[model samples]
Target: MSFPGVRRCHAHRRAPLHAGHRRRTFGGRAGLVLAFALALALGVGGTAAYSALYGSIPTAEAQDRVVVRGGVVRLGTHVYLHANGSHGAIGITRVALVKKCHLRVYLDRQPGDRVVAAVAEEDEAMARLGVQAGISGGIDVVDVRLYRAGRRVCANDRIFGGRSNLWISVTTLARTPRKPATPAPAQPTVPAAPAPPTSSVEPAAAPG
Candidate 1:
Protein backbone atom coordinates (compact mmCIF):
# COMPACT_ATOMS: atom_id res chain seq x y z
CA MET A 1 0.00 0.00 0.00
CA SER A 2 2.99 2.41 -0.13
CA PHE A 3 4.44 2.04 -3.63
CA PRO A 4 5.47 5.55 -5.10
CA GLY A 5 4.93 4.70 -8.85
CA VAL A 6 1.35 3.56 -8.26
CA ARG A 7 0.59 6.72 -6.30
CA ARG A 8 1.83 8.93 -9.21
CA CYS A 9 -0.30 7.02 -11.78
CA HIS A 10 -3.39 7.48 -9.67
CA ALA A 11 -2.86 11.28 -9.40
CA HIS A 12 -2.50 11.65 -13.20
CA ARG A 13 -5.78 9.85 -13.83
CA ARG A 14 -7.69 12.26 -11.47
CA ALA A 15 -6.47 15.51 -13.08
CA PRO A 16 -9.31 18.13 -13.81
CA LEU A 17 -10.15 19.37 -17.37
CA HIS A 18 -9.31 23.09 -18.12
CA ALA A 19 -12.36 25.43 -18.25
CA GLY A 20 -10.70 27.81 -20.84
CA HIS A 21 -10.62 25.04 -23.49
CA ARG A 22 -14.40 24.51 -23.23
CA ARG A 23 -15.10 28.26 -23.46
CA ARG A 24 -12.98 28.60 -26.63
CA THR A 25 -14.86 25.81 -28.49
CA PHE A 26 -18.31 27.11 -27.51
CA GLY A 27 -17.45 30.75 -28.46
CA GLY A 28 -16.22 29.79 -31.92
CA ARG A 29 -19.44 27.92 -32.72
CA ALA A 30 -21.63 30.79 -31.46
CA GLY A 31 -19.76 33.35 -33.57
CA LEU A 32 -20.32 31.35 -36.76
CA VAL A 33 -24.09 31.09 -36.10
CA LEU A 34 -24.39 34.82 -35.43
CA ALA A 35 -22.57 35.69 -38.65
CA PHE A 36 -24.91 33.46 -40.71
CA ALA A 37 -28.06 35.03 -39.23
CA LEU A 38 -26.81 38.56 -39.93
CA ALA A 39 -26.06 37.72 -43.56
CA LEU A 40 -29.54 36.17 -44.05
CA ALA A 41 -31.24 39.27 -42.64
CA LEU A 42 -29.36 41.58 -44.98
CA GLY A 43 -30.18 39.45 -48.01
CA VAL A 44 -33.90 39.41 -47.20
CA GLY A 45 -33.99 43.18 -46.67
CA GLY A 46 -32.24 43.88 -49.98
CA THR A 47 -34.66 41.62 -51.88
CA ALA A 48 -37.71 43.34 -50.40
CA ALA A 49 -36.38 46.79 -51.25
CA TYR A 50 -35.62 45.79 -54.82
CA SER A 51 -39.09 44.27 -55.30
CA ALA A 52 -40.82 47.42 -54.07
CA LEU A 53 -38.79 49.64 -56.40
CA TYR A 54 -39.43 47.39 -59.39
CA GLY A 55 -43.18 47.42 -58.81
CA SER A 56 -43.20 51.23 -58.96
CA ILE A 57 -41.74 51.38 -62.50
CA PRO A 58 -44.06 52.47 -65.32
CA THR A 59 -45.28 50.10 -68.04
CA ALA A 60 -44.70 50.44 -71.78
CA GLU A 61 -48.06 52.07 -72.50
CA ALA A 62 -47.60 54.46 -69.61
CA GLN A 63 -44.23 55.54 -70.92
CA ASP A 64 -45.83 56.18 -74.32
CA ARG A 65 -48.28 58.58 -72.69
CA VAL A 66 -45.40 60.49 -71.13
CA VAL A 67 -43.70 60.75 -74.52
CA VAL A 68 -46.90 62.03 -76.14
CA ARG A 69 -47.30 64.63 -73.39
CA GLY A 70 -43.81 65.89 -74.15
CA GLY A 71 -44.95 66.68 -77.73
CA VAL A 72 -42.00 64.90 -79.30
CA VAL A 73 -43.98 63.03 -82.00
CA ARG A 74 -47.47 61.66 -82.36
CA LEU A 75 -46.88 57.92 -82.48
CA GLY A 76 -50.05 56.56 -84.07
CA THR A 77 -52.46 56.76 -86.97
CA HIS A 78 -53.78 60.33 -86.65
CA VAL A 79 -56.60 62.08 -88.49
CA TYR A 80 -56.18 65.87 -88.61
CA LEU A 81 -59.16 68.19 -89.09
CA HIS A 82 -58.85 71.72 -90.46
CA ALA A 83 -61.55 74.35 -90.99
CA ASN A 84 -61.97 76.30 -94.27
CA GLY A 85 -59.60 79.13 -93.34
CA SER A 86 -56.89 77.16 -91.56
CA HIS A 87 -53.49 77.07 -93.24
CA GLY A 88 -50.39 75.32 -91.91
CA ALA A 89 -48.27 72.23 -92.18
CA ILE A 90 -49.49 68.84 -91.01
CA GLY A 91 -46.98 66.26 -89.91
CA ILE A 92 -47.67 62.55 -90.26
CA THR A 93 -45.60 60.55 -87.82
CA ARG A 94 -46.39 57.17 -89.34
CA VAL A 95 -43.57 55.63 -91.31
CA ALA A 96 -44.25 54.10 -94.74
CA LEU A 97 -42.35 52.85 -97.74
CA VAL A 98 -42.73 55.17 -100.73
CA LYS A 99 -41.80 52.68 -103.44
CA LYS A 100 -44.72 51.02 -105.20
CA CYS A 101 -47.23 52.84 -103.00
CA HIS A 102 -49.98 55.40 -103.67
CA LEU A 103 -51.01 58.35 -101.48
CA ARG A 104 -54.52 59.71 -101.87
CA VAL A 105 -55.65 63.07 -100.52
CA TYR A 106 -59.38 63.74 -100.39
CA LEU A 107 -60.38 67.40 -100.17
CA ASP A 108 -63.62 69.37 -99.77
CA ARG A 109 -63.09 72.93 -100.97
CA GLN A 110 -65.24 75.97 -101.78
CA PRO A 111 -66.23 76.16 -105.48
CA GLY A 112 -64.41 79.36 -106.54
CA ASP A 113 -61.15 78.95 -104.60
CA ARG A 114 -58.24 76.77 -105.74
CA VAL A 115 -56.04 74.75 -103.44
CA VAL A 116 -52.50 74.12 -104.64
CA ALA A 117 -50.83 71.04 -103.20
CA ALA A 118 -47.47 69.33 -103.56
CA VAL A 119 -45.79 66.17 -102.31
CA ALA A 120 -42.19 66.04 -101.20
CA GLU A 121 -39.93 63.80 -99.16
CA GLU A 122 -39.38 66.19 -96.23
CA ASP A 123 -41.85 67.72 -93.79
CA GLU A 124 -40.62 71.32 -94.17
CA ALA A 125 -40.58 71.16 -97.97
CA MET A 126 -43.59 68.84 -98.03
CA ALA A 127 -45.47 71.21 -100.25
CA ARG A 128 -43.39 71.11 -103.40
CA LEU A 129 -45.50 73.85 -105.01
CA GLY A 130 -44.99 76.20 -102.05
CA VAL A 131 -47.69 77.01 -99.50
CA GLN A 132 -50.92 77.07 -101.47
CA ALA A 133 -54.46 77.38 -100.10
CA GLY A 134 -57.91 77.17 -101.58
CA ILE A 135 -60.11 80.24 -101.40
CA SER A 136 -63.42 79.54 -103.22
CA GLY A 137 -63.89 76.08 -104.72
CA GLY A 138 -65.91 72.91 -104.54
CA ILE A 139 -64.62 69.59 -103.24
CA ASP A 140 -61.73 68.35 -105.37
CA VAL A 141 -59.53 65.30 -105.60
CA VAL A 142 -55.84 66.16 -105.81
CA ASP A 143 -53.44 63.48 -106.99
CA VAL A 144 -49.84 63.69 -105.78
CA ARG A 145 -47.24 61.76 -107.78
CA LEU A 146 -44.26 60.19 -106.02
CA TYR A 147 -41.20 58.97 -107.88
CA ARG A 148 -38.60 56.43 -106.88
CA ALA A 149 -35.33 55.94 -108.78
CA GLY A 150 -36.52 58.30 -111.54
CA ARG A 151 -39.74 56.33 -111.91
CA ARG A 152 -43.14 57.40 -110.60
CA VAL A 153 -43.86 54.83 -107.91
CA CYS A 154 -45.78 56.60 -105.16
CA ALA A 155 -48.02 59.61 -104.46
CA ASN A 156 -47.84 62.08 -101.51
CA ASP A 157 -49.07 65.64 -100.96
CA ARG A 158 -50.06 68.38 -98.52
CA ILE A 159 -53.34 70.29 -98.48
CA PHE A 160 -54.25 73.63 -96.84
CA GLY A 161 -57.62 75.34 -96.18
CA GLY A 162 -59.72 72.33 -97.06
CA ARG A 163 -61.69 69.57 -95.40
CA SER A 164 -59.67 66.54 -96.29
CA ASN A 165 -58.27 63.16 -95.28
CA LEU A 166 -55.21 61.13 -96.31
CA TRP A 167 -55.02 57.48 -97.27
CA ILE A 168 -52.33 55.21 -98.67
CA SER A 169 -52.67 52.21 -101.00
CA VAL A 170 -50.12 49.93 -102.61
CA THR A 171 -50.01 49.40 -106.40
CA THR A 172 -49.66 46.04 -108.17
CA LEU A 173 -47.54 47.48 -110.98
CA ALA A 174 -44.28 46.86 -109.17
CA ARG A 175 -44.77 43.11 -109.11
CA THR A 176 -42.62 40.90 -111.29
CA PRO A 177 -43.89 39.99 -114.75
CA ARG A 178 -45.04 36.45 -115.57
CA LYS A 179 -42.90 34.26 -117.77
CA PRO A 180 -43.73 34.04 -121.54
CA ALA A 181 -45.78 31.06 -122.67
CA THR A 182 -43.86 28.19 -124.28
CA PRO A 183 -44.18 27.88 -128.10
CA ALA A 184 -46.42 25.01 -129.21
CA PRO A 185 -44.90 22.27 -131.40
CA ALA A 186 -45.95 22.25 -135.06
CA GLN A 187 -48.58 19.55 -135.97
CA PRO A 188 -47.86 17.04 -138.77
CA THR A 189 -50.17 17.25 -141.84
CA VAL A 190 -51.62 14.13 -143.56
CA PRO A 191 -51.48 13.72 -147.43
CA ALA A 192 -54.83 13.99 -149.22
CA ALA A 193 -56.13 10.79 -150.95
CA PRO A 194 -55.77 10.83 -154.74
CA ALA A 195 -59.06 11.52 -156.52
CA PRO A 196 -60.73 8.19 -157.19
CA PRO A 197 -59.52 6.81 -160.49
CA THR A 198 -61.58 8.66 -163.06
CA SER A 199 -63.97 6.15 -164.51
CA SER A 200 -62.30 5.27 -167.77
CA VAL A 201 -65.22 2.95 -168.47
CA GLU A 202 -67.67 5.89 -168.47
CA PRO A 203 -65.51 7.78 -170.94
CA ALA A 204 -65.41 4.79 -173.31
CA ALA A 205 -69.21 4.42 -173.17
CA ALA A 206 -69.66 8.12 -174.06
CA PRO A 207 -67.39 7.68 -177.12
CA GLY A 208 -69.42 4.62 -178.34
Candidate 2:
Protein backbone atom coordinates (compact mmCIF):
# COMPACT_ATOMS: atom_id res chain seq x y z
CA MET A 1 0.00 0.00 0.00
CA SER A 2 2.98 2.33 0.56
CA PHE A 3 4.21 3.44 -2.86
CA PRO A 4 7.09 5.91 -2.42
CA GLY A 5 6.46 7.81 -5.65
CA VAL A 6 2.72 8.31 -5.00
CA ARG A 7 3.32 9.42 -1.44
CA ARG A 8 5.89 11.95 -2.59
CA CYS A 9 3.46 13.36 -5.16
CA HIS A 10 0.74 13.84 -2.51
CA ALA A 11 3.22 15.53 -0.17
CA HIS A 12 4.26 17.89 -2.93
CA ARG A 13 0.63 18.80 -3.70
CA ARG A 14 -0.12 19.61 -0.02
CA ALA A 15 3.09 21.62 0.33
CA PRO A 16 1.86 24.16 -2.26
CA LEU A 17 -1.51 24.61 -0.51
CA HIS A 18 0.13 25.36 2.85
CA ALA A 19 2.56 27.79 1.20
CA GLY A 20 -0.31 29.46 -0.66
CA HIS A 21 -2.18 30.08 2.60
CA ARG A 22 0.86 31.77 4.16
CA ARG A 23 1.41 33.91 1.11
CA ARG A 24 -2.19 35.09 1.10
CA THR A 25 -2.06 35.99 4.78
CA PHE A 26 1.14 37.95 4.36
CA GLY A 27 -0.17 39.76 1.34
CA GLY A 28 -3.36 40.81 3.13
CA ARG A 29 -1.43 42.22 6.07
CA ALA A 30 0.97 44.07 3.79
CA GLY A 31 -1.90 45.61 1.85
CA LEU A 32 -3.57 46.82 5.02
CA VAL A 33 -0.36 48.36 6.27
CA LEU A 34 0.26 50.03 2.95
CA ALA A 35 -3.22 51.52 2.86
CA PHE A 36 -2.94 52.79 6.40
CA ALA A 37 0.41 54.42 5.70
CA LEU A 38 -0.94 56.11 2.60
CA ALA A 39 -3.93 57.50 4.48
CA LEU A 40 -1.76 58.84 7.28
CA ALA A 41 0.55 60.51 4.82
CA LEU A 42 -2.30 62.18 3.04
CA GLY A 43 -3.86 63.43 6.23
CA VAL A 44 -0.68 64.84 7.70
CA GLY A 45 0.27 66.42 4.40
CA GLY A 46 -3.11 68.06 4.00
CA THR A 47 -3.06 69.59 7.48
CA ALA A 48 0.47 70.94 7.19
CA ALA A 49 -0.22 72.33 3.74
CA TYR A 50 -3.34 74.04 5.00
CA SER A 51 -1.54 75.56 7.96
CA ALA A 52 1.33 76.82 5.86
CA LEU A 53 -0.92 78.47 3.32
CA TYR A 54 -3.06 80.00 6.02
CA GLY A 55 -0.10 81.56 7.79
CA SER A 56 0.93 83.38 4.65
CA ILE A 57 -2.21 85.51 4.59
CA PRO A 58 -1.87 88.74 6.56
CA THR A 59 -4.07 89.86 9.47
CA ALA A 60 -5.16 93.43 10.21
CA GLU A 61 -7.69 95.32 12.28
CA ALA A 62 -9.86 98.37 11.93
CA GLN A 63 -7.57 101.42 11.83
CA ASP A 64 -4.62 99.08 11.68
CA ARG A 65 -2.20 99.83 8.88
CA VAL A 66 -0.59 96.73 7.41
CA VAL A 67 1.94 96.31 4.67
CA VAL A 68 0.54 94.44 1.70
CA ARG A 69 2.93 92.77 -0.67
CA GLY A 70 2.23 89.96 -3.05
CA GLY A 71 0.72 87.37 -0.69
CA VAL A 72 -0.78 83.97 -1.54
CA VAL A 73 -3.03 85.80 -3.97
CA ARG A 74 -0.98 87.15 -6.87
CA LEU A 75 -3.68 89.56 -8.03
CA GLY A 76 -2.59 91.66 -5.05
CA THR A 77 -2.58 90.66 -1.35
CA HIS A 78 -5.24 89.42 1.04
CA VAL A 79 -5.75 90.87 4.53
CA TYR A 80 -8.17 89.50 7.10
CA LEU A 81 -9.77 91.95 9.46
CA HIS A 82 -10.37 90.95 13.04
CA ALA A 83 -14.07 90.19 13.28
CA ASN A 84 -16.39 90.91 16.17
CA GLY A 85 -17.42 87.79 18.04
CA SER A 86 -20.97 89.13 18.25
CA HIS A 87 -21.41 88.36 14.54
CA GLY A 88 -22.81 84.87 15.29
CA ALA A 89 -21.14 81.53 14.57
CA ILE A 90 -18.85 83.39 12.12
CA GLY A 91 -18.38 83.09 8.36
CA ILE A 92 -15.84 83.92 5.72
CA THR A 93 -17.00 87.06 3.94
CA ARG A 94 -15.37 88.86 1.03
CA VAL A 95 -15.90 91.99 -1.08
CA ALA A 96 -13.80 92.23 -4.21
CA LEU A 97 -12.82 95.49 -5.91
CA VAL A 98 -11.82 95.30 -9.57
CA LYS A 99 -9.87 98.54 -9.51
CA LYS A 100 -6.11 98.41 -10.03
CA CYS A 101 -3.37 100.80 -8.78
CA HIS A 102 -5.94 103.16 -7.39
CA LEU A 103 -4.74 103.13 -3.73
CA ARG A 104 -7.89 101.57 -2.31
CA VAL A 105 -8.18 101.13 1.48
CA TYR A 106 -10.79 99.57 3.81
CA LEU A 107 -11.17 99.77 7.56
CA ASP A 108 -13.89 98.97 10.18
CA ARG A 109 -16.19 97.79 7.38
CA GLN A 110 -16.87 101.21 6.00
CA PRO A 111 -19.34 101.82 3.15
CA GLY A 112 -18.43 102.33 -0.54
CA ASP A 113 -14.73 101.57 -0.22
CA ARG A 114 -13.20 98.85 -2.38
CA VAL A 115 -11.65 96.00 -0.37
CA VAL A 116 -9.55 92.92 -1.01
CA ALA A 117 -10.91 90.40 1.46
CA ALA A 118 -12.10 90.71 5.05
CA VAL A 119 -12.62 87.68 7.23
CA ALA A 120 -14.05 86.85 10.63
CA GLU A 121 -11.38 84.45 11.73
CA GLU A 122 -8.12 83.50 10.06
CA ASP A 123 -9.18 79.88 9.72
CA GLU A 124 -12.57 80.76 8.29
CA ALA A 125 -11.17 83.25 5.82
CA MET A 126 -8.29 81.12 4.63
CA ALA A 127 -10.26 77.90 4.49
CA ARG A 128 -12.89 79.61 2.37
CA LEU A 129 -10.90 81.96 0.13
CA GLY A 130 -7.42 80.46 0.06
CA VAL A 131 -7.91 78.80 -3.31
CA GLN A 132 -10.20 81.30 -4.98
CA ALA A 133 -9.23 82.68 -8.41
CA GLY A 134 -8.67 86.28 -9.55
CA ILE A 135 -8.06 87.25 -5.91
CA SER A 136 -6.12 90.50 -6.37
CA GLY A 137 -8.37 92.13 -9.00
CA GLY A 138 -6.41 95.38 -8.59
CA ILE A 139 -3.17 97.11 -7.64
CA ASP A 140 -3.04 99.34 -4.52
CA VAL A 141 -1.13 102.35 -5.75
CA VAL A 142 0.51 104.29 -8.52
CA ASP A 143 4.00 103.84 -9.98
CA VAL A 144 6.23 101.40 -8.14
CA ARG A 145 9.31 103.21 -6.93
CA LEU A 146 12.32 102.37 -4.73
CA TYR A 147 14.35 104.44 -2.28
CA ARG A 148 17.72 105.75 -3.39
CA ALA A 149 20.71 107.08 -1.42
CA GLY A 150 20.56 110.78 -0.39
CA ARG A 151 16.93 111.30 -1.28
CA ARG A 152 13.90 112.79 0.48
CA VAL A 153 11.08 110.27 0.16
CA CYS A 154 7.50 110.02 1.43
CA ALA A 155 5.97 106.85 2.84
CA ASN A 156 3.96 106.08 -0.28
CA ASP A 157 6.95 107.02 -2.39
CA ARG A 158 9.14 104.65 -0.38
CA ILE A 159 6.67 101.77 -0.61
CA PHE A 160 6.41 102.14 -4.35
CA GLY A 161 10.14 102.68 -4.74
CA GLY A 162 11.51 100.20 -2.20
CA ARG A 163 12.57 96.63 -2.86
CA SER A 164 10.19 95.26 -0.25
CA ASN A 165 7.43 92.89 -1.26
CA LEU A 166 4.68 94.75 0.66
CA TRP A 167 3.79 98.16 -0.73
CA ILE A 168 0.25 98.84 0.39
CA SER A 169 -1.11 99.93 3.79
CA VAL A 170 -4.84 99.62 4.41
CA THR A 171 -6.23 101.74 7.19
CA THR A 172 -9.38 103.54 8.39
CA LEU A 173 -10.83 106.46 6.47
CA ALA A 174 -9.02 108.81 8.88
CA ARG A 175 -5.46 109.70 7.90
CA THR A 176 -3.13 106.83 8.54
CA PRO A 177 0.18 107.21 10.31
CA ARG A 178 3.12 107.83 8.00
CA LYS A 179 5.95 105.38 7.98
CA PRO A 180 8.66 106.98 10.10
CA ALA A 181 11.88 107.64 8.22
CA THR A 182 14.78 105.52 9.31
CA PRO A 183 16.98 107.72 11.48
CA ALA A 184 20.62 107.95 10.45
CA PRO A 185 23.08 106.16 12.73
CA ALA A 186 24.23 108.53 15.49
CA GLN A 187 27.89 109.69 15.61
CA PRO A 188 30.05 110.11 18.75
CA THR A 189 30.35 113.71 19.95
CA VAL A 190 33.38 115.22 21.81
CA PRO A 191 32.68 117.90 24.48
CA ALA A 192 34.54 121.16 23.90
CA ALA A 193 37.03 122.29 26.72
CA PRO A 194 35.69 125.24 28.74
CA ALA A 195 37.52 128.54 27.90
CA PRO A 196 40.06 129.64 30.49
CA PRO A 197 38.58 132.19 32.96
CA THR A 198 40.00 135.75 32.47
CA SER A 199 41.00 138.10 35.37
CA SER A 200 38.17 140.63 35.97
CA VAL A 201 40.67 143.49 37.05
CA GLU A 202 42.38 145.81 34.55
CA PRO A 203 45.25 143.31 34.52
CA ALA A 204 43.80 142.57 31.16
CA ALA A 205 44.89 146.07 29.96
CA ALA A 206 48.41 144.95 29.01
CA PRO A 207 50.10 148.20 27.91
CA GLY A 208 50.12 151.59 29.92
Candidate 3:
Protein backbone atom coordinates (compact mmCIF):
# COMPACT_ATOMS: atom_id res chain seq x y z
CA MET A 1 0.00 0.00 0.00
CA SER A 2 3.07 2.40 0.58
CA PHE A 3 5.79 3.41 -1.85
CA PRO A 4 9.29 1.77 -1.39
CA GLY A 5 11.15 5.09 -1.22
CA VAL A 6 9.06 6.36 1.75
CA ARG A 7 9.69 3.11 3.70
CA ARG A 8 13.48 3.44 3.24
CA CYS A 9 13.46 7.08 4.51
CA HIS A 10 11.59 6.11 7.77
CA ALA A 11 14.07 3.26 8.49
CA HIS A 12 17.07 5.57 8.07
CA ARG A 13 15.67 8.16 10.50
CA ARG A 14 14.97 5.60 13.24
CA ALA A 15 18.46 4.08 12.92
CA PRO A 16 20.26 7.38 13.67
CA LEU A 17 18.00 8.22 16.68
CA HIS A 18 18.65 4.78 18.31
CA ALA A 19 22.40 5.10 17.79
CA GLY A 20 22.50 8.61 19.44
CA HIS A 21 20.55 7.36 22.47
CA ARG A 22 23.01 4.50 22.99
CA ARG A 23 26.01 6.87 22.80
CA ARG A 24 24.55 9.25 25.43
CA THR A 25 23.85 6.36 27.82
CA PHE A 26 27.40 5.03 27.53
CA GLY A 27 28.94 8.49 28.06
CA GLY A 28 26.90 9.13 31.26
CA ARG A 29 28.02 5.79 32.74
CA ALA A 30 31.66 6.56 31.99
CA GLY A 31 31.40 9.98 33.67
CA LEU A 32 29.89 8.46 36.80
CA VAL A 33 32.68 5.91 37.10
CA LEU A 34 35.35 8.56 36.65
CA ALA A 35 33.75 10.77 39.30
CA PHE A 36 33.61 7.92 41.80
CA ALA A 37 37.26 7.09 41.26
CA LEU A 38 38.36 10.70 41.75
CA ALA A 39 36.38 11.01 44.95
CA LEU A 40 37.85 7.82 46.38
CA ALA A 41 41.36 8.93 45.62
CA LEU A 42 40.84 12.28 47.31
CA GLY A 43 39.36 10.67 50.38
CA VAL A 44 42.24 8.27 50.76
CA GLY A 45 44.77 11.04 50.30
CA GLY A 46 43.12 13.23 52.90
CA THR A 47 43.10 10.44 55.45
CA ALA A 48 46.76 9.68 54.89
CA ALA A 49 47.71 13.31 55.18
CA TYR A 50 45.86 13.66 58.46
CA SER A 51 47.56 10.62 59.85
CA ALA A 52 50.98 11.84 58.84
CA LEU A 53 50.52 15.21 60.47
CA TYR A 54 49.01 14.09 63.79
CA GLY A 55 50.47 10.66 64.29
CA SER A 56 53.57 11.80 66.16
CA ILE A 57 51.65 13.75 68.78
CA PRO A 58 51.13 11.67 71.86
CA THR A 59 47.64 11.25 73.24
CA ALA A 60 46.30 13.19 76.21
CA GLU A 61 46.38 10.13 78.43
CA ALA A 62 50.00 9.54 77.61
CA GLN A 63 50.99 13.06 78.60
CA ASP A 64 48.99 12.85 81.81
CA ARG A 65 50.96 9.88 83.07
CA VAL A 66 54.41 11.35 82.49
CA VAL A 67 56.29 11.20 85.82
CA VAL A 68 59.09 13.43 86.94
CA ARG A 69 62.09 11.21 87.67
CA GLY A 70 64.69 13.60 89.02
CA GLY A 71 65.94 17.16 88.52
CA VAL A 72 67.30 20.13 90.44
CA VAL A 73 64.71 22.66 91.55
CA ARG A 74 65.95 25.75 93.31
CA LEU A 75 64.32 28.82 94.75
CA GLY A 76 64.97 31.95 92.70
CA THR A 77 67.11 34.52 94.44
CA HIS A 78 66.18 37.50 92.34
CA VAL A 79 63.53 39.72 93.76
CA TYR A 80 60.47 40.71 91.78
CA LEU A 81 59.84 44.34 90.91
CA HIS A 82 56.75 45.95 89.57
CA ALA A 83 56.70 48.24 86.58
CA ASN A 84 57.17 51.22 88.84
CA GLY A 85 60.09 49.46 90.63
CA SER A 86 57.92 48.54 93.60
CA HIS A 87 57.76 45.27 95.54
CA GLY A 88 61.43 44.40 95.05
CA ALA A 89 61.79 42.35 98.25
CA ILE A 90 58.45 40.56 98.15
CA GLY A 91 59.31 36.94 97.20
CA ILE A 92 61.53 34.61 95.17
CA THR A 93 60.98 32.64 91.97
CA ARG A 94 60.63 28.86 92.09
CA VAL A 95 62.70 27.20 89.39
CA ALA A 96 63.42 23.75 88.08
CA LEU A 97 66.84 23.50 86.50
CA VAL A 98 67.16 21.48 83.31
CA LYS A 99 70.07 21.10 80.96
CA LYS A 100 68.17 22.51 77.99
CA CYS A 101 64.54 22.36 79.01
CA HIS A 102 64.56 18.65 78.28
CA LEU A 103 63.23 16.67 81.25
CA ARG A 104 63.61 12.99 81.95
CA VAL A 105 60.20 11.46 82.57
CA TYR A 106 59.01 7.94 83.37
CA LEU A 107 56.06 6.31 81.72
CA ASP A 108 54.06 3.23 82.52
CA ARG A 109 55.26 0.80 79.87
CA GLN A 110 58.53 2.37 78.78
CA PRO A 111 61.73 0.36 79.08
CA GLY A 112 64.06 3.05 80.38
CA ASP A 113 63.05 6.70 80.23
CA ARG A 114 61.88 9.38 77.86
CA VAL A 115 62.80 13.04 77.54
CA VAL A 116 60.24 15.81 77.20
CA ALA A 117 61.08 19.41 76.48
CA ALA A 118 59.06 22.58 76.31
CA VAL A 119 59.59 26.32 76.30
CA ALA A 120 56.29 27.49 77.64
CA GLU A 121 55.10 29.88 80.29
CA GLU A 122 54.00 29.28 83.86
CA ASP A 123 50.33 29.45 83.00
CA GLU A 124 50.66 26.76 80.40
CA ALA A 125 52.37 24.45 82.86
CA MET A 126 49.80 25.21 85.50
CA ALA A 127 47.02 24.33 83.11
CA ARG A 128 48.69 21.07 82.17
CA LEU A 129 49.08 19.98 85.78
CA GLY A 130 47.39 21.60 88.69
CA VAL A 131 49.73 23.32 91.15
CA GLN A 132 49.65 22.74 94.87
CA ALA A 133 50.88 24.80 97.77
CA GLY A 134 53.49 22.32 98.99
CA ILE A 135 55.46 19.26 97.81
CA SER A 136 54.10 17.04 100.57
CA GLY A 137 51.58 15.26 98.32
CA GLY A 138 54.27 13.96 95.99
CA ILE A 139 53.30 15.98 92.93
CA ASP A 140 55.14 15.52 89.66
CA VAL A 141 57.30 18.46 88.61
CA VAL A 142 57.39 18.43 84.86
CA ASP A 143 56.98 22.01 83.68
CA VAL A 144 55.36 24.15 86.38
CA ARG A 145 53.75 23.18 89.64
CA LEU A 146 52.87 25.73 92.23
CA TYR A 147 54.11 24.47 95.56
CA ARG A 148 53.80 28.00 96.83
CA ALA A 149 51.27 30.33 95.37
CA GLY A 150 51.95 34.03 94.78
CA ARG A 151 55.46 33.35 93.58
CA ARG A 152 56.91 34.01 90.14
CA VAL A 153 58.60 31.06 88.43
CA CYS A 154 62.13 31.39 87.02
CA ALA A 155 62.77 28.10 85.22
CA ASN A 156 61.23 27.53 81.83
CA ASP A 157 60.78 23.79 82.27
CA ARG A 158 59.07 22.97 85.59
CA ILE A 159 57.81 25.01 88.53
CA PHE A 160 57.88 23.75 92.08
CA GLY A 161 55.41 24.58 94.82
CA GLY A 162 57.17 25.58 98.06
CA ARG A 163 60.19 27.45 99.32
CA SER A 164 61.70 24.25 100.67
CA ASN A 165 64.56 23.10 98.43
CA LEU A 166 64.38 19.68 100.03
CA TRP A 167 62.02 18.13 97.49
CA ILE A 168 60.87 14.76 98.77
CA SER A 169 59.22 13.92 95.44
CA VAL A 170 62.34 14.02 93.28
CA THR A 171 64.60 10.98 93.29
CA THR A 172 67.68 13.04 93.96
CA LEU A 173 68.52 16.69 93.55
CA ALA A 174 72.07 17.34 92.36
CA ARG A 175 73.89 19.22 95.08
CA THR A 176 75.94 22.33 94.34
CA PRO A 177 79.44 22.09 95.77
CA ARG A 178 80.18 24.56 98.51
CA LYS A 179 83.25 26.78 98.22
CA PRO A 180 85.73 26.34 101.08
CA ALA A 181 86.01 29.26 103.47
CA THR A 182 89.20 31.28 103.35
CA PRO A 183 91.61 30.98 106.30
CA ALA A 184 92.07 33.99 108.56
CA PRO A 185 95.33 35.91 108.20
CA ALA A 186 98.04 35.02 110.71
CA GLN A 187 98.89 37.68 113.37
CA PRO A 188 102.31 39.24 112.91
CA THR A 189 104.78 37.75 115.48
CA VAL A 190 106.20 40.48 117.68
CA PRO A 191 109.99 39.90 117.99
CA ALA A 192 110.86 38.94 121.51
CA ALA A 193 111.87 41.99 123.37
CA PRO A 194 115.54 42.38 122.57
CA ALA A 195 117.47 40.76 125.37
CA PRO A 196 118.93 43.46 127.43
CA PRO A 197 122.23 44.09 125.77
CA THR A 198 124.43 41.53 127.35
CA SER A 199 127.08 43.64 129.00
CA SER A 200 130.44 42.89 127.42
CA VAL A 201 131.28 41.65 130.83
CA GLU A 202 128.27 39.78 132.13
CA PRO A 203 127.86 42.32 134.87
CA ALA A 204 131.16 41.00 136.29
CA ALA A 205 129.55 37.62 136.97
CA ALA A 206 126.61 39.20 138.71
CA PRO A 207 128.68 41.52 140.73
CA GLY A 208 130.76 38.66 142.14
Q: Kindly state the number of residue pairs that clash in model 2.
A: 8
Q: lDDT of all the models against the reference?
A: 0.33, 0.33, 0.35
lDDT, candidate 3, equals: 0.35
Q: Can you write out model 2's per-residue Cα lDDT over 67-142, one digit (the tens) per residue?
A: 2322111122332222345322111133233233322222233233344443211122222333211112223321
TM-score of each: 0.20, 0.20, 0.17
Candidate 1 is scored at a TM of 0.20
lDDT of 2: 0.33
Error of 2 at 145 (Å): 25
TM-score of 3: 0.17
**Which sections of candidate 2 miss by over 4 Å?**
1-50, 53-65, 68-136, 139-182, 200-208
lDDT of 3 at 97: 39
Off by over 4 Å in 3: 1-72, 78-141, 147-163, 166-208
